[model samples]
Target: MAKGSNCSRWVLCSLVKLVFNDAYISTKIHHRQVSPLRRPPTAAIAGRARVPGFGTRVNRVCVRAVISEGDKKKTMVETSKELNESAVESGGWVDVRAVITIRKKMKENLNEKIEDQWEYVVNGMGQGICLQLISDQIDPVTKSGKSIESYVRGWMPKPLSHPHIVAYMANFKVPHDFGCPGAILITNFHGKEFYLTEIVVHGFKEGPIFFPANSWIHSRKDNPESRIIFKNKAYIPSQTPPGIKDLRREDLLSIRGNGKGERKMHDRIYDYAPYNDLGNPDKGEDLARPVLSGEEMPYPRRCRTGRPPTKSEPFSESRIEKPHPVYVPRDETFEEIKQNTFSAGRLKALLHNLIPSIASALSSSDISFKCFSEIDKLYNDGVVLKDEEQNIIDNQFLGNLMRRVLTAGQQLLKYEIPAIIKSDRFVWLRDNEFARQTLAGGQPKQELHLHRMSVEEAIENKRLFILDYHDMLLPFMERMNSLPGRKAYASRTVFVCTRTDYPYAADGLLIWSAIKELVESYVEHFYPEPGLVTSDLELQAWWNEVKNKGHYDKRNEPWWPKLDTKEDLCGILTTMIWIASGQHAAINFGQYPFGGYVPNRPTLMRKLIPHEDEPEYEKFIHNPQRFFLSSLPTQLQATKVMAVQDTLSTHSPDEEYLGQVHHLQSHCNSDHQVQIMFKKFSSKLEEIEKTINARNKDIRLRNRSGAGIPPYELLLPLSGPGVTGRGIPNSVSI
Candidate 1:
């Protein structure tokens, strides 16, 4: 199996199990249970004792332990370094392991599981074995009382003692364990340190699988993380995010660990996750994006800011005392929020438009050019005209022809750049910026038809959709957004003509369907009935937390769906998934590819179209392209944005794609239902890839496979490392 495939296999216990069966380990130092928060004392604690046993008294040792769970049938072991002469002065070996007791009813299949596991350890790892045994005279995991026994039993070919094992520690302690047993295989039979290059988990519906160990258990010094699988079986340390999910359309940057010292791991989450859950604030705030403050000092060139296209501009939300996810710049730093603001900051949409797949490509606020390269080429061909000396001429402009094919607007004059650029000969479609922006991809309008089609007829035919961002943002444009080097408009939005919209929507549906199916199956398995959905306390808690914290400003909006039925829950999950994966992928990966060409998707329109009588127009008649380039983002902003885009768009080697979400370390033998459904989801994604491949080949899809058009495969599920302009990760892992 490839490294990015399956995650470690132990399944996490649910809320019920968390509440009732959690396991914890503590020993008295000053004759009291050690505080989980207090760091272990180090100055006088560098020694070990030769004694080995648990249940009688605290015997201090210098070596650390790599612990795992033990049962009659199945067992896993983990080992550490040999006794530290320097630190092995004296200390008790804490039996921080869960010893599970199986009932007679569950014993029928217990032997089979044991046999399989025994074969797994013996055949895969080989002989000369050592095993420990202990009855629950005193429960070792939770010290309701004292002295719990510690032991492991596995098969080995020869009889030999595995000695001198050492255990490493991290900064903090591990979290609680639900009823699930701890797990791992450890041996000191060999002298060299055994690094976990891979971890194979069994019992998933897809059978046994090996995943990259670095993703979870990083024993290497570079990214040292070696937490026991049972450490956070019930919960890991996590924090509720402060409304950063909306950044980059949804940046759920969080952690998924509680391992101390070398066992520390940095994991990400989706929504409101358990302290150990990588989905929410529990640990996400640690990775929350810092707001970019001030601005990059414009480069050597004379940087210019256009007049407020609208009188009002917003530096923040309209009615808030401070933005909900208020971004305060750190120090006087001049760095972009590259991690959280993928698409927008790519071209620095905060200064221009182009909110990625989130804002419709049609909206003045969102630039949808990656999939519209052909149209941009046509816009360049027919509209950009020049004389023998390269001066732009108004009469020579292909006005009528442009009107026939593109969304052309009234001509304007006087926007200029004193640099080499002479005039505003590049006439931007400012006439109906609203129409140009929103008509193509609104929510309900569905209006991307031929120019000849009547608006009423188009609407009647269901060719239009509008998300109504114009009114929502208009009020703040004049007040909060008017920073220097910015172009703010009241009625900016996204529009898409089903035909011209290219693959964002069409191909995105492929990903959406697979995600929806997986979410639905998961919901069915967990909820089972509407009543179950309504009664689910944790589920509702998560939903309420998302709204109150994620969209705190708009939590009162009437559109918030009540979680009364499973269908409602499914819809919510699907929408969030689409935003994070498919939609984000569409707007993202294409950053440098589309935004690299400044003329096509201008970052900021510094100069407006000059009127024929204006002096700028006279300059426009002299040199056109330079004037056009000057109207966009200044060279400084453009180059900086490009650099930022390159970094953001490139997928790292450890990327986890949409259907390939593993790395979730399990602490117990897994349940097969959800894993089976996830496996099917992955299969469906493969099917989607084939369909997209076929679509790109068929000449029937003109926008997709037409001449001069790059085959629209940005939505294809797989991609190699780096910025190949594809791959939909499971979440916005900012």
Candidate 2:
């Protein structure tokens, strides 16, 4: 090792002369990169840059660092060897190898970090054009597209000219009521068309194949655009009515807007009038924008996506850009796809345009939401308000904490339930299929309804409610889950209502019952007699304080139970303990497992489902996966969300849980009854944990216990620190 150090010193001096010319060293030691493959004279001329009029295939670079500490020489190496040998013998400065190894490891780590950062930068540049393949059958086109054609089911996967990149997207279920009484919703590519971008079959047949078709996944024979006319239960291939009829007057009115571009005609203010002077608005002749004649005004008829999906009516919201004939960037291969790599100059140019908006979004000092928030706000606003009219009553309105929302499934509006009613509401709302939907899907099992009671009885028993969003979301489930980034159960979450139903519910019930028993045991031991609860001023004061002060708003409510008996005391304590401990554990801790993988719970919905009337429909039929990817979260958004969810779901190192309440034991050690209750409570918690484990192994409860479902361990009584995802904390620790 000592010899190697001396050897490095010997080689260093000679290499400097051999590597760089006298012109590079004598002129100036410039800190710059030059491609090793480029001409030598080019570097000398530009000083630190490549000269113009040169081959720009810039690949590798040469870097140089000058050691200016008295320089390196052959005699110096001999002196360095002598110093090292003398130091090693005396052991004054020890372990030369240790220093070398540490430095080498540091360099390796630095290189690794540098490589990772470089990859991030490179991938970020290609985010718009690049995607990876996931899950292909290898069994080619069979049962998709224009169902009138017979499906043979034995078509083999054939190799195309270029390797097909399958951009895997989140697959979602659409109900029978969606998309023209069910067109392609039940089949492959059961997604609505997005008009933003086109799905292209690049290098298709090495040339244009007369009729466009999805040769990879669907059909090679049929023209995808030409519908079957859907007569008997299928119209326009599968349509109830053409997606929202025309709004032409409003389209022209937008060009001559009331604000600044007001056009006056025939002693009246005509919002849709096209004046002759269509240039300057200051000339008093209101001119229409986009510099077009009256005939060129687009969107004369109502278009499917004339406005965003969030807007229930065609022109319900204030929007001017009625993209009449939506342009589809389909079929033509992107520049990077054609060339197979993005150029440095082109990337720099793109960053030049995007960096400002990206920086603004990330920067705390000047955060901006103009890019995506407006569209998102509209989607969220569709719940109880539309067209500036508030739909929810004042009493029902629970003022928003996070700027808004509904509490669950207490109310239902006509616009919110498109899956049920085509237009107007006729059927009186009922819970006839509610129990069935929550259990074995739409199938009504006779056993499930064995204990069916009146709504009044169910409500009084406190088993009427659900974890929620089932009824609220059934209408938009297809469109909501179809989004590329976000996956939520506004439509499908209703069935998972009770504690005995699903993973969180079934396992959570074990913890709840254990705590309830603990509470009842504690109340019985403390109170002893019914009069003891009345005479105990301390207990009375505590109950009074809780009702009159803690929950002052609900102080006068009829629901408040009279604490005259031990049973009343037991119920209140059990509820308080369950809410703080088991209930919160079921909902809070499993955030990462449910959401960390962006596809499962994508944070953003980049695109909307495309309708059949758009040009994008032509492209979607060719490559469904491309549209799927675009409709969800992009690569960057998923990464960011994963990190946040992971942090949020993590447990603290010094964490406390339901069974491990040692602090309470320390204070209650003097009282034997308190000590006895704690022991029984801890024992009960352990037993509950075993029961949960047994239930997880059970195959009957398919939502959680089945092989496909992740075991419901979020309420599994015990866990260690750091994002365990499963643990019954004693309180809402998060």
Best by TM-score: 1
| Cα lDDT tens digits for candidate 1, 1-734 | 00000001111122111111111110000000000111122221012112132222322211122333333113233221111211111243212322211111122267655653443353223221111111112234332111212222233222112111111221111112212122222222221112222233222222232222221222123222212222222211121111111110111111211223221112211111111111222234453322222232111110011111211222211221232322111111111222333433343323222112212322344232323232234224322222321221223476455334323321111111211111222222222222322222212233345466566655675655555657766767665445554554444343434454346667887788887787777667655656766554434554654554334345677988887787887787677667766878878877755454455355566555577988899766787655655556643454446556655677756455766642222322144565576668778999999999998898887656544445677799888766677777654444
What's the CA error at residue 606 for candidate 2, in Å? 3.3
Stretches of candidate 1 exceeding 4 Å from the true structure = 1-452, 465-502, 661-669
Taking all chains together, the TM-score of candidate 2 against the true structure is 0.36
List TM-score per model, in order: 0.49, 0.36
User: Cα deviation of 133 in candidate 1 (Å)?
Assistant: 12
All candidates' lDDT scores? 0.37, 0.34
User: Model 2, stretches more than 4 Å misplaced?
Assistant: 1-501, 614-620, 663-668, 699-701, 705-708
Model 2: worst 10 consecutive residues (lDDT sum) = 95-104
User: lDDT by residue for model 2 over 663-720, one digit each (tens)?
Assistant: 2112212235555766687788788788878877777755444323456677887898
